[model samples]
Target: MERQADWRQEKAQALARARVVVIKVGSAVLTDAQGLSTPVLESLARQMAALRTAPDGHERRLVLVSSGAVAAGRAVLRAHGHSGETSGLSARQAAAAVGQGQLMRAWDEVFRAYDFPTSQVLLTRDDLRARQRFLNARNTFAELMDWGVLPIVNENDTVSVSELKFGDNDCLASLLVNLIGADLYINLTSAPGVYAANPQEVPDAGILECVEDVAGLDLGRMCGGKTSVGTGGMYSKLQAARRAAQLGVPTLILPGREADVLARAFGGEAVGTWVRPEEHAIPRRKFWLAYQSDPAGTVLVD
Candidate 1:
Protein backbone atom coordinates (compact mmCIF):
# COMPACT_ATOMS: atom_id res chain seq x y z
CA MET A 1 0.00 0.00 0.00
CA GLU A 2 1.21 3.51 -0.77
CA ARG A 3 1.50 6.10 1.97
CA GLN A 4 -0.22 9.47 1.73
CA ALA A 5 -0.66 12.50 3.95
CA ASP A 6 -4.24 13.42 4.91
CA TRP A 7 -4.41 16.90 3.46
CA ARG A 8 -8.00 17.32 4.58
CA GLN A 9 -6.83 18.66 7.95
CA GLU A 10 -7.16 22.31 8.97
CA LYS A 11 -3.47 23.23 9.02
CA ALA A 12 -3.07 21.63 5.61
CA GLN A 13 -5.64 24.02 4.19
CA ALA A 14 -4.14 26.97 6.08
CA LEU A 15 -0.71 26.10 4.71
CA ALA A 16 -2.00 26.05 1.19
CA ARG A 17 -3.34 29.55 1.60
CA ALA A 18 -0.28 30.83 3.41
CA ARG A 19 1.08 33.66 1.22
CA VAL A 20 4.69 32.79 1.96
CA VAL A 21 6.39 29.84 3.62
CA VAL A 22 10.03 29.29 4.47
CA ILE A 23 11.15 25.69 4.92
CA LYS A 24 14.52 24.68 6.36
CA VAL A 25 16.21 21.32 5.70
CA GLY A 26 19.09 20.14 7.84
CA SER A 27 22.21 18.19 6.84
CA ALA A 28 21.08 15.13 8.75
CA VAL A 29 17.97 14.83 6.63
CA LEU A 30 19.85 15.50 3.40
CA THR A 31 22.96 13.48 4.03
CA ASP A 32 24.23 10.15 5.23
CA ALA A 33 27.61 9.34 6.87
CA GLN A 34 29.28 9.56 3.46
CA GLY A 35 27.11 12.39 2.01
CA LEU A 36 23.96 13.90 0.37
CA SER A 37 20.75 11.90 0.23
CA THR A 38 19.11 11.90 -3.18
CA PRO A 39 15.77 10.52 -2.02
CA VAL A 40 15.33 13.20 0.64
CA LEU A 41 15.64 16.09 -1.78
CA GLU A 42 13.38 14.32 -4.26
CA SER A 43 10.76 13.77 -1.56
CA LEU A 44 10.94 17.39 -0.48
CA ALA A 45 10.34 18.53 -4.05
CA ARG A 46 7.31 16.27 -4.27
CA GLN A 47 5.66 17.89 -1.23
CA MET A 48 6.35 21.40 -2.47
CA ALA A 49 4.86 20.45 -5.83
CA ALA A 50 1.61 19.39 -4.17
CA LEU A 51 1.12 22.76 -2.50
CA ARG A 52 1.85 24.44 -5.80
CA THR A 53 -1.03 22.47 -7.30
CA ALA A 54 -3.53 22.96 -4.50
CA PRO A 55 -6.65 24.88 -5.56
CA ASP A 56 -8.33 27.68 -3.59
CA GLY A 57 -5.76 30.21 -4.78
CA HIS A 58 -3.29 28.43 -2.55
CA GLU A 59 -0.58 28.50 -5.20
CA ARG A 60 2.08 28.66 -2.52
CA ARG A 61 5.21 30.77 -2.57
CA LEU A 62 8.11 28.93 -0.95
CA VAL A 63 11.78 29.34 -0.04
CA LEU A 64 13.93 26.38 0.97
CA VAL A 65 16.92 27.03 3.28
CA SER A 66 19.11 23.94 3.04
CA SER A 67 22.25 22.78 4.92
CA GLY A 68 24.74 20.12 3.78
CA ALA A 69 27.27 21.87 1.62
CA VAL A 70 30.05 21.20 4.07
CA ALA A 71 29.09 17.55 4.40
CA ALA A 72 28.92 17.09 0.69
CA GLY A 73 32.14 18.99 0.15
CA ARG A 74 33.97 16.99 2.77
CA ALA A 75 32.89 13.77 1.10
CA VAL A 76 34.48 14.90 -2.15
CA LEU A 77 37.64 15.95 -0.36
CA ARG A 78 37.90 12.62 1.44
CA ALA A 79 37.94 10.83 -1.93
CA HIS A 80 41.08 12.80 -2.78
CA GLY A 81 42.77 11.82 0.53
CA HIS A 82 42.90 15.47 1.62
CA SER A 83 41.48 14.62 5.11
CA GLY A 84 38.93 17.43 4.54
CA GLU A 85 40.12 19.32 7.64
CA THR A 86 42.22 22.34 8.52
CA SER A 87 43.79 24.05 11.53
CA GLY A 88 40.78 26.25 12.25
CA LEU A 89 39.07 28.18 9.42
CA SER A 90 40.39 26.10 6.52
CA ALA A 91 38.46 22.95 7.45
CA ARG A 92 35.02 24.52 7.07
CA GLN A 93 35.96 26.61 4.06
CA ALA A 94 37.39 23.52 2.31
CA ALA A 95 34.25 21.49 2.98
CA ALA A 96 32.07 24.29 1.64
CA ALA A 97 34.23 24.64 -1.46
CA VAL A 98 33.69 20.98 -2.35
CA GLY A 99 30.02 20.88 -1.32
CA GLN A 100 28.24 24.07 -2.45
CA GLY A 101 28.32 23.17 -6.14
CA GLN A 102 27.49 19.55 -5.42
CA LEU A 103 24.55 20.58 -3.28
CA MET A 104 23.20 23.12 -5.76
CA ARG A 105 23.55 20.86 -8.78
CA ALA A 106 21.77 18.01 -7.05
CA TRP A 107 18.92 20.28 -6.01
CA ASP A 108 18.75 21.72 -9.50
CA GLU A 109 18.39 18.31 -11.08
CA VAL A 110 15.66 17.12 -8.71
CA PHE A 111 13.76 20.41 -8.72
CA ARG A 112 13.95 20.46 -12.49
CA ALA A 113 12.13 17.13 -12.62
CA TYR A 114 9.14 18.90 -11.10
CA ASP A 115 9.75 21.87 -13.38
CA PHE A 116 10.47 23.90 -10.28
CA PRO A 117 13.05 26.55 -11.07
CA THR A 118 15.48 27.24 -8.25
CA SER A 119 17.99 29.99 -7.54
CA GLN A 120 20.99 29.68 -5.25
CA VAL A 121 21.47 32.47 -2.70
CA LEU A 122 24.36 31.98 -0.24
CA LEU A 123 24.20 34.32 2.77
CA THR A 124 26.25 35.30 5.79
CA ARG A 125 25.30 36.73 9.22
CA ASP A 126 26.84 39.98 8.19
CA ASP A 127 24.22 40.22 5.50
CA LEU A 128 21.45 40.20 8.09
CA ARG A 129 23.22 42.13 10.87
CA ALA A 130 24.00 45.14 8.69
CA ARG A 131 20.96 47.32 7.99
CA GLN A 132 21.74 48.14 4.35
CA ARG A 133 22.70 44.60 3.28
CA PHE A 134 19.79 43.19 5.25
CA LEU A 135 17.30 45.40 3.46
CA ASN A 136 18.76 44.56 0.06
CA ALA A 137 18.71 40.85 0.80
CA ARG A 138 15.09 41.12 1.99
CA ASN A 139 14.11 42.95 -1.17
CA THR A 140 15.87 40.30 -3.22
CA PHE A 141 13.84 37.55 -1.54
CA ALA A 142 10.58 39.45 -2.10
CA GLU A 143 11.41 39.96 -5.75
CA LEU A 144 12.25 36.27 -6.19
CA MET A 145 8.93 35.20 -4.65
CA ASP A 146 7.11 37.76 -6.72
CA TRP A 147 8.64 36.16 -9.80
CA GLY A 148 7.76 32.64 -8.57
CA VAL A 149 11.28 31.33 -8.18
CA LEU A 150 12.30 29.02 -5.34
CA PRO A 151 15.23 30.58 -3.51
CA ILE A 152 17.46 27.82 -2.10
CA VAL A 153 19.67 29.49 0.48
CA ASN A 154 22.63 28.33 2.53
CA GLU A 155 25.40 30.01 4.46
CA ASN A 156 28.27 31.18 2.29
CA ASP A 157 30.51 28.63 3.92
CA THR A 158 33.25 28.96 1.31
CA VAL A 159 34.08 32.49 2.39
CA SER A 160 33.08 32.45 6.05
CA VAL A 161 35.49 32.21 8.97
CA SER A 162 35.45 28.96 10.94
CA GLU A 163 32.60 28.39 13.42
CA LEU A 164 30.65 31.30 11.96
CA LYS A 165 28.70 29.90 9.05
CA PHE A 166 24.98 30.65 9.74
CA GLY A 167 26.21 28.21 12.46
CA ASP A 168 23.16 26.12 11.60
CA ASN A 169 20.23 26.37 9.24
CA ASP A 170 17.78 26.77 12.14
CA CYS A 171 19.06 30.26 12.97
CA LEU A 172 19.28 30.93 9.25
CA ALA A 173 15.68 29.78 8.85
CA SER A 174 14.46 32.08 11.62
CA LEU A 175 16.28 35.06 10.16
CA LEU A 176 14.97 34.19 6.72
CA VAL A 177 11.40 34.27 8.06
CA ASN A 178 12.11 37.59 9.73
CA LEU A 179 13.53 38.96 6.51
CA ILE A 180 10.73 37.71 4.28
CA GLY A 181 7.89 38.33 6.72
CA ALA A 182 6.80 34.78 6.04
CA ASP A 183 3.47 33.46 7.25
CA LEU A 184 4.97 30.19 8.41
CA TYR A 185 8.44 28.85 9.16
CA ILE A 186 8.59 25.06 8.86
CA ASN A 187 11.62 23.08 9.99
CA LEU A 188 11.72 19.66 8.37
CA THR A 189 14.12 17.26 10.08
CA SER A 190 14.56 13.53 10.83
CA ALA A 191 13.30 13.47 14.41
CA PRO A 192 9.60 12.84 15.07
CA GLY A 193 8.74 15.68 17.45
CA VAL A 194 9.80 17.16 20.76
CA TYR A 195 9.42 14.38 23.33
CA ALA A 196 8.41 14.90 26.97
CA ALA A 197 11.47 12.90 28.00
CA ASN A 198 14.50 11.97 25.96
CA PRO A 199 13.00 9.01 24.12
CA GLN A 200 16.27 7.19 23.54
CA GLU A 201 16.85 7.21 27.28
CA VAL A 202 13.21 6.92 28.36
CA PRO A 203 11.39 4.08 26.66
CA ASP A 204 8.07 5.94 26.80
CA ALA A 205 9.06 9.55 26.41
CA GLY A 206 6.04 11.69 25.71
CA ILE A 207 5.74 13.78 22.61
CA LEU A 208 4.92 17.44 23.12
CA GLU A 209 1.92 18.27 20.92
CA CYS A 210 1.91 22.01 21.24
CA VAL A 211 3.87 24.89 22.70
CA GLU A 212 1.93 27.91 23.99
CA ASP A 213 4.91 29.45 25.77
CA VAL A 214 8.48 28.21 25.30
CA ALA A 215 9.81 29.26 28.70
CA GLY A 216 7.36 26.80 30.22
CA LEU A 217 9.28 23.93 28.65
CA ASP A 218 12.69 22.61 29.65
CA LEU A 219 14.24 22.64 26.14
CA GLY A 220 17.82 22.34 27.33
CA ARG A 221 17.18 18.66 27.98
CA MET A 222 15.69 18.17 24.50
CA CYS A 223 18.75 17.27 22.39
CA GLY A 224 22.20 18.39 21.29
CA GLY A 225 23.56 19.94 18.06
CA LYS A 226 24.37 18.24 14.73
CA THR A 227 24.38 14.56 15.57
CA SER A 228 25.99 13.66 12.26
CA VAL A 229 27.28 15.62 9.29
CA GLY A 230 24.62 18.27 10.05
CA THR A 231 25.16 20.98 12.62
CA GLY A 232 21.64 21.31 14.02
CA GLY A 233 19.28 19.28 16.13
CA MET A 234 15.85 19.57 17.80
CA TYR A 235 17.26 22.28 20.07
CA SER A 236 17.78 24.73 17.24
CA LYS A 237 14.41 23.83 15.74
CA LEU A 238 12.65 24.75 18.97
CA GLN A 239 14.68 27.93 19.27
CA ALA A 240 13.76 28.82 15.68
CA ALA A 241 10.08 28.32 16.42
CA ARG A 242 10.31 30.29 19.64
CA ARG A 243 11.92 33.20 17.86
CA ALA A 244 9.39 33.00 15.05
CA ALA A 245 6.48 33.00 17.52
CA GLN A 246 7.81 36.10 19.22
CA LEU A 247 7.80 37.73 15.78
CA GLY A 248 4.12 36.77 15.26
CA VAL A 249 4.92 33.97 12.80
CA PRO A 250 3.69 30.52 13.76
CA THR A 251 6.19 27.65 13.37
CA LEU A 252 5.94 23.91 12.88
CA ILE A 253 8.87 21.58 13.55
CA LEU A 254 8.60 18.03 12.24
CA PRO A 255 10.50 15.13 10.74
CA GLY A 256 11.26 15.34 7.04
CA ARG A 257 12.22 11.69 6.56
CA GLU A 258 9.39 11.39 4.08
CA ALA A 259 8.02 13.63 1.35
CA ASP A 260 4.54 13.82 2.89
CA VAL A 261 5.76 15.23 6.23
CA LEU A 262 5.21 18.75 4.94
CA ALA A 263 1.53 18.01 4.30
CA ARG A 264 1.39 16.00 7.52
CA ALA A 265 2.77 18.89 9.58
CA PHE A 266 0.08 21.30 8.45
CA GLY A 267 -2.63 18.65 8.18
CA GLY A 268 -2.71 18.10 11.95
CA GLU A 269 -1.63 14.50 12.06
CA ALA A 270 0.48 15.24 15.12
CA VAL A 271 3.62 14.74 13.09
CA GLY A 272 5.49 17.44 15.04
CA THR A 273 5.20 20.28 17.56
CA TRP A 274 3.41 23.56 16.93
CA VAL A 275 4.28 26.86 18.64
CA ARG A 276 1.88 29.74 18.30
CA PRO A 277 2.47 33.45 18.73
CA GLU A 278 1.31 35.18 21.89
CA GLU A 279 -1.67 37.57 22.03
CA HIS A 280 0.43 40.70 22.16
CA ALA A 281 2.92 39.52 19.58
CA ILE A 282 6.26 41.23 19.86
CA PRO A 283 7.17 43.54 17.01
CA ARG A 284 9.86 42.20 14.68
CA ARG A 285 12.47 44.66 15.90
CA LYS A 286 11.70 43.96 19.54
CA PHE A 287 11.66 40.24 18.98
CA TRP A 288 15.13 40.54 17.48
CA LEU A 289 16.23 42.64 20.39
CA ALA A 290 15.07 40.06 22.88
CA TYR A 291 16.26 36.98 21.04
CA GLN A 292 19.05 38.00 18.67
CA SER A 293 20.60 40.68 20.84
CA ASP A 294 24.22 40.07 21.79
CA PRO A 295 25.06 38.76 25.24
CA ALA A 296 27.25 41.72 25.92
CA GLY A 297 28.07 43.94 28.85
CA THR A 298 24.88 45.30 30.43
CA VAL A 299 23.82 48.17 32.60
CA LEU A 300 20.43 48.85 34.16
CA VAL A 301 18.61 52.17 34.51
CA ASP A 302 16.12 52.25 37.32
Candidate 2:
Protein backbone atom coordinates (compact mmCIF):
# COMPACT_ATOMS: atom_id res chain seq x y z
CA MET A 1 0.00 0.00 0.00
CA GLU A 2 2.83 2.42 0.69
CA ARG A 3 4.44 1.58 -2.64
CA GLN A 4 1.14 2.16 -4.40
CA ALA A 5 0.77 5.54 -2.76
CA ASP A 6 4.27 6.50 -3.81
CA TRP A 7 3.59 5.69 -7.45
CA ARG A 8 0.26 7.49 -7.44
CA GLN A 9 1.86 10.61 -6.02
CA GLU A 10 4.68 10.42 -8.53
CA LYS A 11 2.28 10.21 -11.46
CA ALA A 12 0.23 13.08 -10.12
CA GLN A 13 3.29 15.28 -9.80
CA ALA A 14 4.39 14.42 -13.32
CA LEU A 15 1.00 15.38 -14.69
CA ALA A 16 0.92 18.59 -12.70
CA ARG A 17 4.35 19.59 -13.89
CA ALA A 18 3.74 18.79 -17.55
CA ARG A 19 4.15 22.03 -19.49
CA VAL A 20 3.62 20.53 -22.92
CA VAL A 21 1.03 17.78 -23.51
CA VAL A 22 -0.19 15.82 -26.50
CA ILE A 23 -3.85 14.82 -26.17
CA LYS A 24 -5.36 12.23 -28.51
CA VAL A 25 -9.10 11.77 -28.41
CA GLY A 26 -10.43 8.59 -30.04
CA SER A 27 -13.33 8.61 -32.53
CA ALA A 28 -15.61 6.57 -30.29
CA VAL A 29 -15.53 9.36 -27.74
CA LEU A 30 -16.01 12.19 -30.24
CA THR A 31 -18.76 10.85 -32.47
CA ASP A 32 -22.10 9.12 -32.21
CA ALA A 33 -25.06 8.11 -34.44
CA GLN A 34 -25.60 11.73 -35.46
CA GLY A 35 -21.92 12.42 -36.28
CA LEU A 36 -19.33 14.56 -34.46
CA SER A 37 -20.67 15.41 -31.03
CA THR A 38 -20.40 19.16 -30.62
CA PRO A 39 -21.37 18.85 -26.97
CA VAL A 40 -18.41 16.62 -26.27
CA LEU A 41 -16.06 18.99 -28.08
CA GLU A 42 -17.38 21.92 -26.10
CA SER A 43 -16.93 20.08 -22.84
CA LEU A 44 -13.37 19.10 -23.74
CA ALA A 45 -12.58 22.62 -24.84
CA ARG A 46 -13.70 23.98 -21.49
CA GLN A 47 -11.48 21.53 -19.66
CA MET A 48 -8.56 22.27 -21.96
CA ALA A 49 -8.94 25.99 -21.37
CA ALA A 50 -8.46 25.40 -17.69
CA LEU A 51 -5.42 23.24 -18.40
CA ARG A 52 -3.72 25.88 -20.57
CA THR A 53 -3.59 28.32 -17.67
CA ALA A 54 -2.05 26.28 -14.90
CA PRO A 55 -2.98 27.12 -11.33
CA ASP A 56 0.67 27.55 -10.40
CA GLY A 57 1.21 30.39 -12.94
CA HIS A 58 2.97 28.12 -15.42
CA GLU A 59 1.43 28.12 -18.89
CA ARG A 60 0.82 24.83 -20.73
CA ARG A 61 1.07 24.10 -24.44
CA LEU A 62 -1.27 21.49 -25.96
CA VAL A 63 -1.38 19.58 -29.20
CA LEU A 64 -4.61 17.82 -30.07
CA VAL A 65 -4.57 14.63 -32.16
CA SER A 66 -8.16 13.88 -33.11
CA SER A 67 -9.79 11.03 -35.06
CA GLY A 68 -13.36 11.18 -36.35
CA ALA A 69 -13.31 12.30 -40.00
CA VAL A 70 -14.38 9.06 -41.62
CA ALA A 71 -16.89 8.32 -38.90
CA ALA A 72 -18.38 11.77 -39.16
CA GLY A 73 -18.44 11.58 -42.96
CA ARG A 74 -20.17 8.21 -42.86
CA ALA A 75 -22.88 9.63 -40.65
CA VAL A 76 -23.48 12.57 -42.97
CA LEU A 77 -23.44 10.39 -46.07
CA ARG A 78 -25.80 7.86 -44.48
CA ALA A 79 -28.41 10.54 -43.94
CA HIS A 80 -28.11 11.35 -47.65
CA GLY A 81 -29.04 7.87 -48.91
CA HIS A 82 -25.58 6.35 -48.66
CA SER A 83 -24.47 3.33 -46.68
CA GLY A 84 -22.31 3.91 -43.64
CA GLU A 85 -20.21 0.84 -44.42
CA THR A 86 -17.62 2.03 -46.90
CA SER A 87 -16.75 -0.72 -49.37
CA GLY A 88 -13.13 -0.11 -50.31
CA LEU A 89 -10.12 2.08 -49.62
CA SER A 90 -11.34 4.63 -52.13
CA ALA A 91 -14.75 4.77 -50.48
CA ARG A 92 -13.23 5.33 -47.10
CA GLN A 93 -11.00 8.05 -48.51
CA ALA A 94 -14.03 9.76 -49.92
CA ALA A 95 -15.67 9.70 -46.51
CA ALA A 96 -12.58 11.20 -44.93
CA ALA A 97 -12.46 13.96 -47.51
CA VAL A 98 -16.05 14.87 -46.86
CA GLY A 99 -15.77 14.77 -43.11
CA GLN A 100 -12.38 16.31 -42.47
CA GLY A 101 -13.80 19.79 -42.97
CA GLN A 102 -16.66 19.14 -40.60
CA LEU A 103 -14.35 17.71 -38.00
CA MET A 104 -12.08 20.74 -38.10
CA ARG A 105 -14.96 23.15 -38.04
CA ALA A 106 -16.38 21.53 -34.93
CA TRP A 107 -13.04 21.81 -33.14
CA ASP A 108 -12.34 25.31 -34.38
CA GLU A 109 -15.72 26.60 -33.27
CA VAL A 110 -15.49 25.14 -29.80
CA PHE A 111 -11.99 26.44 -29.12
CA ARG A 112 -12.77 29.81 -30.60
CA ALA A 113 -15.48 30.26 -27.98
CA TYR A 114 -12.77 30.07 -25.33
CA ASP A 115 -10.54 32.59 -27.18
CA PHE A 116 -8.08 29.93 -28.24
CA PRO A 117 -6.81 29.82 -31.82
CA THR A 118 -6.22 26.50 -33.56
CA SER A 119 -4.34 25.36 -36.64
CA GLN A 120 -4.97 22.21 -38.67
CA VAL A 121 -1.89 20.15 -39.43
CA LEU A 122 -2.34 17.13 -41.68
CA LEU A 123 0.64 14.81 -42.09
CA THR A 124 1.59 11.51 -43.74
CA ARG A 125 4.32 9.01 -42.93
CA ASP A 126 6.29 10.07 -45.97
CA ASP A 127 6.51 13.63 -44.67
CA LEU A 128 8.56 12.52 -41.67
CA ARG A 129 10.53 9.81 -43.43
CA ALA A 130 13.02 12.30 -44.86
CA ARG A 131 15.45 13.83 -42.37
CA GLN A 132 15.08 17.42 -43.64
CA ARG A 133 11.30 17.12 -43.69
CA PHE A 134 11.29 15.76 -40.17
CA LEU A 135 13.34 18.70 -38.92
CA ASN A 136 11.10 21.13 -40.80
CA ALA A 137 7.99 19.63 -39.19
CA ARG A 138 9.62 19.92 -35.79
CA ASN A 139 10.44 23.57 -36.42
CA THR A 140 6.86 24.25 -37.44
CA PHE A 141 5.55 22.71 -34.21
CA ALA A 142 7.97 24.83 -32.22
CA GLU A 143 6.71 28.01 -33.86
CA LEU A 144 3.09 27.03 -33.26
CA MET A 145 3.71 26.39 -29.60
CA ASP A 146 5.64 29.61 -29.26
CA TRP A 147 2.70 31.48 -30.66
CA GLY A 148 0.31 29.97 -28.11
CA VAL A 149 -1.69 28.22 -30.82
CA LEU A 150 -3.22 24.83 -30.42
CA PRO A 151 -2.02 22.57 -33.23
CA ILE A 152 -4.73 20.12 -34.19
CA VAL A 153 -3.03 17.19 -35.90
CA ASN A 154 -4.45 14.32 -37.91
CA GLU A 155 -3.42 11.85 -40.60
CA ASN A 156 -4.14 13.06 -44.11
CA ASP A 157 -6.41 10.05 -44.53
CA THR A 158 -7.91 11.28 -47.79
CA VAL A 159 -4.52 11.05 -49.51
CA SER A 160 -2.74 8.51 -47.29
CA VAL A 161 -2.77 5.06 -48.80
CA SER A 162 -2.22 2.02 -46.60
CA GLU A 163 1.47 1.88 -47.51
CA LEU A 164 2.04 5.50 -46.45
CA LYS A 165 -0.43 5.86 -43.60
CA PHE A 166 0.65 6.42 -39.98
CA GLY A 167 -1.67 3.44 -39.13
CA ASP A 168 -3.76 5.44 -36.64
CA ASN A 169 -3.98 8.64 -34.64
CA ASP A 170 -2.46 6.87 -31.63
CA CYS A 171 0.74 6.26 -33.61
CA LEU A 172 0.68 9.82 -34.84
CA ALA A 173 0.37 11.05 -31.27
CA SER A 174 3.42 9.02 -30.27
CA LEU A 175 5.44 10.67 -33.00
CA LEU A 176 4.16 14.08 -31.93
CA VAL A 177 5.42 13.45 -28.41
CA ASN A 178 8.94 13.12 -29.81
CA LEU A 179 8.52 16.00 -32.23
CA ILE A 180 7.69 18.49 -29.47
CA GLY A 181 9.53 16.77 -26.66
CA ALA A 182 6.28 16.68 -24.76
CA ASP A 183 6.15 16.24 -21.01
CA LEU A 184 3.08 14.02 -21.09
CA TYR A 185 0.94 12.12 -23.57
CA ILE A 186 -2.74 11.86 -22.70
CA ASN A 187 -4.88 9.40 -24.68
CA LEU A 188 -8.57 9.87 -24.06
CA THR A 189 -10.74 6.97 -25.19
CA SER A 190 -14.19 5.58 -24.51
CA ALA A 191 -12.91 3.23 -21.84
CA PRO A 192 -11.68 4.42 -18.46
CA GLY A 193 -8.28 2.75 -18.63
CA VAL A 194 -6.34 -0.39 -19.48
CA TYR A 195 -8.15 -3.48 -18.17
CA ALA A 196 -7.02 -7.00 -17.30
CA ALA A 197 -9.47 -8.23 -19.95
CA ASN A 198 -11.83 -6.65 -22.42
CA PRO A 199 -14.39 -5.13 -20.11
CA GLN A 200 -17.19 -5.94 -22.53
CA GLU A 201 -16.31 -9.62 -22.55
CA VAL A 202 -15.49 -9.88 -18.86
CA PRO A 203 -17.89 -7.48 -17.21
CA ASP A 204 -15.98 -7.60 -13.95
CA ALA A 205 -12.49 -7.19 -15.39
CA GLY A 206 -10.37 -4.91 -13.22
CA ILE A 207 -8.68 -1.85 -14.64
CA LEU A 208 -4.91 -1.86 -14.48
CA GLU A 209 -4.01 1.46 -12.89
CA CYS A 210 -0.30 1.43 -13.57
CA VAL A 211 1.91 -0.24 -16.17
CA GLU A 212 5.49 -0.27 -14.87
CA ASP A 213 7.02 -2.46 -17.57
CA VAL A 214 5.20 -2.21 -20.89
CA ALA A 215 7.49 -4.58 -22.78
CA GLY A 216 7.09 -7.44 -20.32
CA LEU A 217 3.29 -7.62 -20.52
CA ASP A 218 1.39 -10.17 -22.60
CA LEU A 219 -0.36 -7.58 -24.76
CA GLY A 220 -2.02 -10.24 -26.93
CA ARG A 221 -3.97 -11.63 -24.01
CA MET A 222 -4.69 -8.19 -22.58
CA CYS A 223 -6.06 -6.49 -25.67
CA GLY A 224 -7.65 -7.78 -28.89
CA GLY A 225 -10.98 -6.05 -29.19
CA LYS A 226 -11.46 -3.01 -31.44
CA THR A 227 -14.16 -0.41 -31.55
CA SER A 228 -16.21 0.07 -34.71
CA VAL A 229 -15.86 3.85 -34.70
CA GLY A 230 -12.11 4.13 -34.12
CA THR A 231 -9.23 2.72 -36.14
CA GLY A 232 -7.13 2.06 -33.01
CA GLY A 233 -7.84 -0.48 -30.29
CA MET A 234 -6.34 -1.04 -26.86
CA TYR A 235 -3.46 -2.92 -28.48
CA SER A 236 -2.45 0.08 -30.56
CA LYS A 237 -2.66 2.33 -27.50
CA LEU A 238 -0.29 0.05 -25.59
CA GLN A 239 2.11 0.00 -28.52
CA ALA A 240 2.00 3.78 -28.72
CA ALA A 241 2.50 4.06 -24.98
CA ARG A 242 5.50 1.77 -25.26
CA ARG A 243 6.93 4.01 -27.96
CA ALA A 244 6.36 7.13 -25.84
CA ALA A 245 7.89 5.35 -22.86
CA GLN A 246 10.98 4.63 -24.90
CA LEU A 247 11.24 8.36 -25.61
CA GLY A 248 11.05 9.11 -21.86
CA VAL A 249 7.47 10.35 -21.87
CA PRO A 250 4.77 8.77 -19.74
CA THR A 251 1.27 8.09 -21.16
CA LEU A 252 -2.14 8.25 -19.51
CA ILE A 253 -5.13 6.42 -20.93
CA LEU A 254 -8.30 7.87 -19.50
CA PRO A 255 -12.04 8.05 -20.09
CA GLY A 256 -12.76 10.77 -22.67
CA ARG A 257 -16.50 11.15 -22.16
CA GLU A 258 -16.37 12.03 -18.49
CA ALA A 259 -16.64 15.69 -17.60
CA ASP A 260 -13.36 17.24 -16.41
CA VAL A 261 -11.57 13.94 -16.82
CA LEU A 262 -8.29 15.65 -17.72
CA ALA A 263 -8.66 17.99 -14.79
CA ARG A 264 -9.36 15.13 -12.44
CA ALA A 265 -6.43 13.04 -13.64
CA PHE A 266 -4.02 15.95 -13.56
CA GLY A 267 -5.24 16.85 -10.10
CA GLY A 268 -4.03 13.47 -8.76
CA GLU A 269 -7.35 11.69 -8.86
CA ALA A 270 -5.72 8.68 -10.58
CA VAL A 271 -8.58 8.10 -12.98
CA GLY A 272 -6.65 6.17 -15.63
CA THR A 273 -3.79 3.79 -16.36
CA TRP A 274 -0.36 5.40 -16.28
CA VAL A 275 2.55 3.98 -18.31
CA ARG A 276 5.79 5.16 -16.76
CA PRO A 277 8.74 6.17 -18.92
CA GLU A 278 12.00 4.24 -19.11
CA GLU A 279 14.91 5.31 -16.95
CA HIS A 280 16.80 6.75 -19.92
CA ALA A 281 15.55 8.45 -23.06
CA ILE A 282 16.22 7.05 -26.52
CA PRO A 283 18.72 8.98 -28.59
CA ARG A 284 17.08 11.15 -31.25
CA ARG A 285 18.86 9.53 -34.20
CA LYS A 286 18.06 6.02 -32.99
CA PHE A 287 14.43 6.88 -32.31
CA TRP A 288 14.08 8.21 -35.85
CA LEU A 289 15.82 5.20 -37.36
CA ALA A 290 13.55 2.81 -35.48
CA TYR A 291 10.22 4.62 -35.94
CA GLN A 292 10.42 6.84 -39.04
CA SER A 293 12.46 4.73 -41.44
CA ASP A 294 11.21 1.76 -43.44
CA PRO A 295 13.61 -1.13 -43.63
CA ALA A 296 14.94 -2.11 -47.03
CA GLY A 297 16.29 -5.48 -46.00
CA THR A 298 16.39 -7.68 -42.92
CA VAL A 299 19.23 -9.86 -41.69
CA LEU A 300 18.32 -13.15 -40.01
CA VAL A 301 20.19 -13.99 -36.85
CA ASP A 302 20.69 -17.57 -35.81
In terms of lDDT, the best-performing candidate is 2
Q: After superposition, how far is residue 182 of candidate 1 from its true place, in Å?
A: 0.4
Residue-level lDDT for 226 in candidate 2: 78
Q: lDDT of candidate 1 vs native?
A: 0.76
Model 1, range 1-302, lDDT digits (tens) per residue?
A: 32124323434655656778899988888888678888888888888876665556556789999988888887787778887344256777777887999999999988898888899999877777766777899899988888878999998877876434567789889988888888888888877777767665676877777666765667777654456666777777888887777676777778888658877665557678766654456677665555444456889999
- The Cα error of candidate 1 at residue 206, in Å, is 2.4
lDDT of 2 by residue, 210-297 (tens): 9988877888888867788888899999999999999888899999999889888877786889998877889867888999987888
Q: Alpha-carbon error at 144 in model 1, in Å?
A: 0.9
Backbone Cα, N, C clashes tallied per candidate: 3, 0
**So what's the TM-score on candidate 2?**
0.94
TM-score of each candidate structure, all chains considered together? 0.87, 0.94
Candidate 2: misplaced stretches above 4 Å? Answer: 1-5, 296-302
